[model samples]
Target chain A: MALHPYDPVAGAALRNVPLAEVDSKDRSLALSRPWQLRPSLLASIASHGILTPLRLRPKQNGLMQVVHGFRRFEAARRLGLPSIPGLVLASRNLLKLFLQALEEGRTARTLSSLENAAALRTLKYRFNVPEKRLIEEFLPLLDLKENRRTLRLHLDLAVLPDALQQALERGLENETALRLSGRPEDFQSLCCRLILSFQLGKNRQKKLVEMLDEILAAASKQEVQSVEEVWRELGCAALENRADLTPADRWKRILALLRQARYPALSRHQARFDELKAALKLPPPVRLQAPRYFEGSSLEISMTVREARQLDGLARELKRISGSQEWEELFRLL
Target chain B: MQPYKPEKVFVERAVAESVITRNVLGNLPMAQVEWIDEAGQMVDKSRRWNPSIARAKQSLVLARHPGRFFKPCPAGTTKTGRRNVCCNYFVVNFASNCHMECSYCYLQAYLNLPYMVVHANVEDLLDELGQVFSSNPRSHYRVGTGELADSLALDSLTGYSRPLVEFFAGFTNAALEFKTKSNCVENLLQLDHRGRTVVSWSINPPTVVQAEEHKTASFEQRLAAAEKCSAAGYPIVFHFDPLIHYPEWEKDYRSLVEEIFQRIPPRSVPWVSLGALRMPPRLKALVRERFPRSGLPLGELLPTEDGKLRYFKPIRVEMLSKMRAWITAASPQTRIYSCMENTDVWQKVFQSQQPPSEVELGDSLLQLL
Candidate 1:
């Protein structure tokens, strides 16, 4: 079979291919990059056809498979075009095809972490690329560590459910998504929805995931049978009426609940400390502070006095407070 | 003695020419060896480093000490006394991690590096210690090597204990303790320590050992090894630290104490310390993550004033007081102290809030010498 030379450098050829006849099957091996119909791009293509041709290979059927230009093909189909311009190729080399598509995609727009993971997965399973080569050669090519542990983590993220994977693509950090994936499947979906809807940043996302993990650990220790029961036990309904609260405030409340569940003793100590601090209302100038974590045996009371009169006033207040039973109880708590 | 078998050996280029490095490499012939330069680049760098899985599977690393070899132990203060009570206690860093997988081990959180690293420069460590001992002629020093790594777990591979024991033998005022849960004492048996070396075992009930201490010697094996060391004229110490509160804990602990006194003479065991189970708040998550089935973190723990989670004061007092009585009945002459315990706990357990000062403690320990 004498085939014409396909420009490997430019890697595209202009040809008319029927939109209906372009086979998008076998896309399981295509890097599963998320596609959203950007109105601007659609309108531009609608006004003046696709400037770049779709990359396609002839299938066993009469149809040609669109390998690199999924978005352009979809837009052409939406515009009711009978045929679109495409780059005709004559090879079934999956690895070569993937690299070309990835290169073109990279030049056009930045690929998300999940997109990179999908490409790595295709190279791994479809091309049978060894893990060593994938981590050392291919991952560094994608600006990732040449380490097996990190490769495995990303590959795990690639196989997550669509909603979670989409959330990861939407700006969740790889580590945060991985942490969420550690939860039970149903709980992972719920967390993914909450995280995406709330639009949490990296720090808040990490906190939410950590709080979820702590709550789950406590529930598991208590032998709670279901996630619903755990959520109910945490009184998650209280968050419903907090519509006025900002996302950070809501996250703080959720964290407080998890902290109370995880460290009941610390919570009790904090409550007691707060009560004591409120009851012992000394002068505003006299600052009283308890040790952090209540792990110390002393409370620090301080006041800056510039005059002898001020010193005597402070001394008198201290003497009066020293006789109170609250002082005794506070020290005993310490 | 169990032989040290590391999966991969990384040598710093600065120490690649040292005899200890060569000897260690020659010992582990089958381990993959690579020389890393100052930039942390391996000579034959490949993508074969699977540190996470290898660490989980107990990989070991042999490297040189990068900086100072000795560090003074922190003068950990208690509620009663905010004083430096360590009394010249120091730790030598010959190793950085342990192979044993105790569920409650703080190393899971402390060590950032996954592989067990053994610092190969023992001569440098000895030289540094000799200077300290020579400069401070009047003070008695209690030095140990088990702070970061088990003392004897890799003694057979490195032969660290022999040189350490031999070094301390010449000093009448300094003592070296090899604290471990392993039964690797064959190297110690051959050395003429002259009572300068103390072999201490971190002991627990057999059930706890089986449930929590993975890959460590069984209680019976540990006690048998302790008896062997005692017979060899080495002062013996036992530490019942992190005493867990489990079902029928009293019965278990009592039997453990009885078993210890039955096998060896109590007079030979000079020091026995009891510390109830406690951990930093951050460590609980690590424990649960590493050992999912572990119930150690699910106990009735309370936050103390020191930011550590411990059993309630009354619970700790009861546990300590009961253990004290059992040990006293078994060996009245044995001196028992509490590790990291506060003044109130010491008072409640020992009937005296004013325990011996650091010098007094040092003098009493020297009596065993």
Candidate 2:
């Protein structure tokens, strides 16, 4: 069945109705994964207050469908806010409105596949939902409790014989297929074609094995010490493992994988990721901002590449490089 | 629910002076039996700690009862017997239970047990078991000692599960399950009882293991241990009993079942049982006093004929259905059974009017032995 985005009425007049005015007895809240909350984000909202309004559209009932910022909407409600601001789009013009919404959001227009995939999940669960009659919903129909969590390396990737799935789980950018769904055929084809083709000679293979040995040893040791540490170490280890393969190779595999993933929908979500990237790229336009610490200094950043690299080599680098010209140049470029 | 009462209270704690005898008369390795030094042994049966709660009419005995009053032995079949069991099960006494309070344990209620002092003697208990199994080798006695203490709780310091592993090694007639939330299998790692000892572990989601099932090994770690046992050629079992009907049960249960199939191949899963929350009358009262914040026993508890307050049957069936669907998806070949359930639930959820006879299940298990 075809699923169009939920396009509710899009107008400034209907935007800020008190929740009391919206009759919502029969409407189910947008389906979501609860554990996906980022604590720092929540703390930011609680401290500084929500800077952006939550995006929403109307559904069958009077209920407002969360178009985006589901977590922010929830955090606001949890913070005991009386009402929240939202955008309401029409159901008939879902695809166009969704794309437009993205464009308005992601003005810069270039975003990573990872950012795109995350946007898709947020959109699927937090914004547009499949109409009930649609068979085999593209988004796994989660009843609030189910999470679209980051897949474990072993089960989602390593456990499978397919190198593609393994690559995706390791967060390797797959631009080829870039599919999120793990349909057996795509995985098998990629396994036979891409992964098998990538195997190195016996000695390089041995180095890979030795690398795996050291990583596993470190992972095991980290498992005993701290899970967060283990995760960071394994994440770095996984990236290191994937580092041997070039970006072209990674994107090729990612595209091949797009079919088994939520990535393509995300790549198409050019608007949202771009917006976030734009937000990150924009400077405070003021002198004092996120005080970075490097090389015995806790100040603003402006450093040259050499000084930055020197700072990078330092045990405490941020302070040293923060106020350097290189840092400001890097920030401006970023 | 009326506040609390100790089910099997002993006015005096039994001081068992005895040590386990090594009567290994065959090829089976005599276990490395770690005993509570005579000073720690509760030698007197006449002492106040006589723990034998009635499972139907039979009074199951315990030498020394730990004084964690209000230990609720939530009723169930798989909770008692191992393999696809057909029998009654409950905790004899709850005390400083498993040293490792696995994150997924219902024994979070067992925190009430006075921590310290391992209850020593099981020799006479073995004598009772020896009589029952010998007389009814065909009777198919299905029982487990780990429900209260992790069968191997003191296995390292006490090496308890090893002797039972050795003892039950010969009881091809009976099926003894050593259920634990702990990964401490150093004692049972070397034993040769093939299938008589159905080694099992309570499983949880990776997040739960890392978070709530505190101090216990990670889900992968536990699965690795199970895998280790399976590689050493042991048919292992997994239990999702007390399947907490929590947020993201689908994700958590899915993660668990996914890892289970990925880790322990279907051929190795001797049996897997599905259960939902159930609390004894006293446990409801006790856990509230101890874990005032523990929402488990507080929500929607009503009395059952057994004096425990469990979810209404339909609610439990719904809970089990979610679990059953996930298991069915993963390893349909693995024998899936409901623990401590009755006929109607058996028919509806598992599609069985009744579980096969205990003897039949025992025979199937022993064939592996």
Candidate 3:
């Protein structure tokens, strides 16, 4: 195979092609999803009439395939324009055309996360580029770290359901999305719904997914199969649909329920500690706390003294609790 | 257990003429051998090689260590610099990795060198120890060779144990322990260890052996080896370290205790150490990625103060206490202690508020003998 030096945009003749003859449905050579005609782009094209020509390659039956400018092409079609300016290239190589499309898209603006995944998926599956080449050569071209995990993540992200991708566009983190990519569809959908409804931050999003995953794994030993069943069994489904509560409160309730389900013994121990602490009747400015995870050998008691007189009451409470049964129970819990 | 037949062997040029290197190459007659200038450079160049830890174990490297061979056991202190109740132990890192792959092995996150490394300069190690021992004639030391690698996993090929056993036989102030999970005790049967060397086995229940300990000796094989070593007048020690939690762990561990006492004489065993399953945070992800079917990550593990994931305090306490009880019932005279535990755990297990110091723990083991 002889190597040819090819310029993707050089020597391309610009022509005005009728919108009816251009077939944007054939996205085999496309590096992005079918044109999402944004309002601004539509307005720009509607006023200026497609100033920049759409990139096209001639089909055998006097038809043209839109390669790079799907948005501009869609805008022209919707605006009832008869013809749009386009550049028709002579080269028929699919890989070169894909690269041309990718480079053009990249130079126009940074590709969105989905567009990056789309480019990688097309380069790998459609153009028959080896994965090693994609990871080593093309990943760097797309400003991705050259590693298999990155390649796998982007490839996985490209194949997620449209709703989940839309959720990602709505600011669902890519890292979170990659984590949810491997779960069943129902789990992914439920998680996406929760994340969107609660407007979960990055940490909360991560915690929600991890809690559900671990709960499902633990429940599987008892013959439970799905996250939905675990949710319903833990009474999280009812809390999930509790319209009376705010999204924030619902998220808190659902997360607390999941955490309890995940760590039943620890929850019980914590509840016992809370009960003992309450029974001790320590007044305000005095807090009794167990060690994190009850891993320490002793409990911690701290009193915040705002005034000199407050110290007397704190001292009294502390002295009273020193010989209390609740104190002994708290130590025993630790 | 299957013999470790590495697919390739890389020999550092500095140790190309070493006896251990020659012995290893001689045993691996069909392996592809390459002579490299430096092992560290080789490792640095291969940093990007992202092979599975198990697959990386299939390549062996025989290199000369450039650093001191002896150090204090890392378990003496937790990662947060909190003092742990260690056994005043010292470690001799004669190798860098283990051939047998355990799902929870810390070397999965500890070792940077991908290939299994055996330091070929054994005579230098012996000479350094000889110097250290002569300088401090009255101090007693309990040194182990299983800190960075299994002491006996590569014994068949390297034959490093014979010299070590024979070397420690000359000293009265230090005891050498060859801790391993392998059944390679054939070489020890013929060596005169002079009661200064103890053969320790890190044993688990049969279910754990089958499920997590991949390509290592089975429980019965380890027990039989213990019996053989005991018969040869070598003191036998067992470390039930990384005792995993499961639904029937108590039953399985009780069976393990009963079987060991039934076979080996109680007098030949010195002490047993119990450690609950704990690991650094990074190892959890590696375990999930490498051994997805493992039940290890399913346990309700929480991060302790030391930044290592462990069973909850109550669960660990219950498990360790039960293990102590079963071991004590099986061999009343045999001492039991906890490994890498804090003072609180030690006190709880022993039903005492005060715990022993490191030197006291070491001296107690000697007094038991």
Local accuracy of candidate 2 as per-residue lDDT tens digits, A88-142? 5455555555555554444534433333444344444545544231113322321
After TM-score superposition, the amount by which residue B193's alpha carbon in candidate 3 deviates from its true location, in angstroms, is 0.2
The C-alpha RMSD in Å for every predicted model, in order, reads 6.4, 28.5, 4.1
- Candidate lDDT values, in order: 0.76, 0.49, 0.86
Ranking by DockQ: 3, 1, 2
lDDT of 1 by residue, A24-45 (tens): 5546645654355567878999
Model 2: docking quality category? incorrect
Question: Positional deviation of B100 in candidate 3, in angstroms?
Answer: 1.7
At residue B302, what lDDT does model 1 achieve? 69
TM-score for predicted model 2 compared with the true structure = 0.40
Which scores higher on lDDT, 1 or 2? 1
State the C-alpha RMSD over the true interface residues for candidate 1, after superposing those residues: 3.9
Q: What DockQ, between 0 and 1, does each candidate earn?
A: 0.17, 0.01, 0.66
* Model 1 chain B worst lDDT window (10 residues): B38-47
Q: What does the lDDT read for residue B79 in candidate 3?
A: 73
> What value does DockQ give for candidate 3?
0.66
